[model samples]
Target: MKRVINFWSLLGFISVSAFLATEIAVVAAAVVWGISSLFGLAMVPTIALGILVGVPSLYGMVKATILAFQAETDPENN
Candidate 1:
Protein backbone atom coordinates (compact mmCIF):
# COMPACT_ATOMS: atom_id res chain seq x y z
CA MET A 1 0.00 0.00 0.00
CA LYS A 2 2.75 2.41 0.86
CA ARG A 3 4.56 1.65 -2.36
CA VAL A 4 1.42 2.19 -4.37
CA ILE A 5 0.76 5.52 -2.72
CA ASN A 6 4.32 6.63 -3.32
CA PHE A 7 4.11 5.65 -6.96
CA TRP A 8 0.92 7.61 -7.45
CA SER A 9 2.38 10.65 -5.74
CA LEU A 10 5.44 10.49 -7.91
CA LEU A 11 3.31 10.18 -11.01
CA GLY A 12 1.25 13.15 -9.99
CA PHE A 13 4.36 15.23 -9.43
CA ILE A 14 5.74 14.31 -12.83
CA SER A 15 2.45 15.08 -14.54
CA VAL A 16 2.22 18.51 -12.92
CA SER A 17 5.82 19.33 -13.70
CA ALA A 18 5.40 18.38 -17.35
CA PHE A 19 2.29 20.51 -17.67
CA LEU A 20 3.92 23.50 -15.97
CA ALA A 21 7.00 23.24 -18.11
CA THR A 22 4.93 23.23 -21.28
CA GLU A 23 2.98 26.24 -20.11
CA ILE A 24 6.15 28.13 -19.27
CA ALA A 25 7.62 27.31 -22.64
CA VAL A 26 4.55 28.59 -24.42
CA VAL A 27 4.64 31.87 -22.47
CA ALA A 28 8.35 32.30 -23.10
CA ALA A 29 7.93 31.69 -26.80
CA ALA A 30 5.10 34.17 -26.97
CA VAL A 31 7.14 36.83 -25.22
CA VAL A 32 10.05 36.26 -27.55
CA TRP A 33 7.83 36.41 -30.59
CA GLY A 34 6.24 39.61 -29.37
CA ILE A 35 9.61 41.18 -28.77
CA SER A 36 10.87 40.11 -32.16
CA SER A 37 7.84 41.65 -33.80
CA LEU A 38 8.76 45.00 -32.25
CA PHE A 39 11.93 44.92 -34.34
CA GLY A 40 9.87 44.67 -37.57
CA LEU A 41 9.95 40.88 -37.82
CA ALA A 42 6.42 40.79 -39.29
CA MET A 43 5.37 38.50 -36.46
CA VAL A 44 3.02 40.87 -34.69
CA PRO A 45 -0.01 38.93 -35.85
CA THR A 46 1.62 35.66 -34.84
CA ILE A 47 2.50 37.12 -31.46
CA ALA A 48 -1.08 38.15 -30.96
CA LEU A 49 -2.12 34.65 -31.86
CA GLY A 50 0.31 33.25 -29.35
CA ILE A 51 -1.06 35.46 -26.60
CA LEU A 52 -4.58 34.36 -27.43
CA VAL A 53 -3.61 30.72 -27.16
CA GLY A 54 -1.07 30.91 -24.33
CA VAL A 55 -3.27 32.65 -21.76
CA PRO A 56 -5.82 29.88 -21.54
CA SER A 57 -3.15 27.22 -21.57
CA LEU A 58 -1.42 28.92 -18.68
CA TYR A 59 -4.67 29.25 -16.72
CA GLY A 60 -5.42 25.57 -17.16
CA MET A 61 -1.97 24.63 -15.93
CA VAL A 62 -2.36 26.77 -12.80
CA LYS A 63 -5.76 25.26 -12.10
CA ALA A 64 -4.41 21.76 -12.56
CA THR A 65 -1.54 22.42 -10.16
CA ILE A 66 -3.91 23.63 -7.48
CA LEU A 67 -6.19 20.66 -7.94
CA ALA A 68 -3.30 18.20 -7.86
CA PHE A 69 -1.94 19.69 -4.66
CA GLN A 70 -5.36 19.57 -3.09
CA ALA A 71 -5.72 15.95 -4.07
CA GLU A 72 -2.36 15.12 -2.54
CA THR A 73 -3.07 16.82 0.77
CA ASP A 74 -6.74 16.21 1.29
CA PRO A 75 -7.61 13.20 3.43
CA GLU A 76 -11.26 12.93 2.56
CA ASN A 77 -10.70 11.28 -0.78
CA ASN A 78 -8.13 8.89 0.59
Candidate 2:
Protein backbone atom coordinates (compact mmCIF):
# COMPACT_ATOMS: atom_id res chain seq x y z
CA MET A 1 0.00 0.00 0.00
CA LYS A 2 1.10 3.51 -0.74
CA ARG A 3 1.83 5.50 2.38
CA VAL A 4 0.14 8.83 2.70
CA ILE A 5 1.67 11.34 5.05
CA ASN A 6 -0.93 13.46 6.80
CA PHE A 7 -0.72 17.24 6.70
CA TRP A 8 -0.70 17.61 10.50
CA SER A 9 2.06 15.09 10.84
CA LEU A 10 4.16 16.88 8.25
CA LEU A 11 3.58 20.19 10.00
CA GLY A 12 4.57 18.78 13.38
CA PHE A 13 7.67 17.25 11.83
CA ILE A 14 8.66 20.60 10.37
CA SER A 15 8.16 22.31 13.72
CA VAL A 16 10.22 19.75 15.54
CA SER A 17 12.93 20.00 12.86
CA ALA A 18 13.11 23.74 13.27
CA PHE A 19 13.56 23.52 17.02
CA LEU A 20 16.24 20.85 16.79
CA ALA A 21 18.07 22.64 13.99
CA THR A 22 18.14 25.88 15.93
CA GLU A 23 19.58 24.21 18.99
CA ILE A 24 22.18 22.37 16.95
CA ALA A 25 23.26 25.52 15.15
CA VAL A 26 23.53 27.47 18.38
CA VAL A 27 25.65 24.82 20.04
CA ALA A 28 27.86 24.45 17.01
CA ALA A 29 28.35 28.20 16.76
CA ALA A 30 29.25 28.43 20.43
CA VAL A 31 31.77 25.61 20.15
CA VAL A 32 33.42 27.11 17.09
CA TRP A 33 33.51 30.54 18.63
CA GLY A 34 34.94 29.22 21.87
CA ILE A 35 37.71 27.39 20.08
CA SER A 36 38.60 30.38 18.00
CA SER A 37 38.50 32.66 21.03
CA LEU A 38 40.85 30.35 22.90
CA PHE A 39 43.34 30.76 20.08
CA GLY A 40 43.11 34.54 20.44
CA LEU A 41 41.61 35.00 17.01
CA ALA A 42 39.94 38.28 16.09
CA MET A 43 36.25 38.63 16.90
CA VAL A 44 35.26 39.03 13.27
CA PRO A 45 36.97 35.85 12.11
CA THR A 46 35.57 33.93 15.03
CA ILE A 47 32.06 35.01 14.20
CA ALA A 48 32.60 34.10 10.55
CA LEU A 49 33.93 30.71 11.50
CA GLY A 50 30.97 30.16 13.78
CA ILE A 51 28.59 30.90 10.94
CA LEU A 52 30.36 28.46 8.63
CA VAL A 53 30.20 25.74 11.25
CA GLY A 54 26.60 26.50 12.15
CA VAL A 55 25.30 26.16 8.60
CA PRO A 56 26.56 22.62 8.15
CA SER A 57 25.44 21.66 11.63
CA LEU A 58 21.95 22.88 10.88
CA TYR A 59 21.82 20.73 7.76
CA GLY A 60 23.01 17.68 9.66
CA MET A 61 20.58 18.26 12.49
CA VAL A 62 17.66 18.70 10.09
CA LYS A 63 18.54 15.50 8.27
CA ALA A 64 18.80 13.61 11.53
CA THR A 65 15.50 15.00 12.70
CA ILE A 66 13.87 13.92 9.44
CA LEU A 67 15.21 10.40 9.87
CA ALA A 68 13.93 10.22 13.43
CA PHE A 69 10.49 11.39 12.40
CA GLN A 70 10.42 8.91 9.54
CA ALA A 71 11.33 6.08 11.87
CA GLU A 72 8.58 7.01 14.28
CA THR A 73 5.97 7.35 11.56
CA ASP A 74 6.92 4.29 9.54
CA PRO A 75 3.66 2.58 8.75
CA GLU A 76 5.21 -0.81 8.14
CA ASN A 77 6.59 -1.03 11.66
CA ASN A 78 3.34 -0.10 13.30
Error of 1 at 26 (Å): 7.4
Model 1 alpha-carbon drift over 4 Å, by segment: 1-42
TM-score of each: 0.50, 0.65
User: How does model 1 fare in lDDT?
Assistant: 0.67
lDDT of 2 by residue, 1-78 (tens): 544377766676677777877788778978896789789888798888877887788789978797857854567744
Clashes of each: 0, 0
Which residue pairs show backbone clashes in model 1? none
Residue 66 in model 1: shift from native, Å? 0.5
Lowest summed-lDDT stretch of 10 residues in model 2?
A: 1-10
lDDT of 1 by residue, 35-56 (tens): 6667655567667767776776
- TM-score between model 1 and native: 0.50
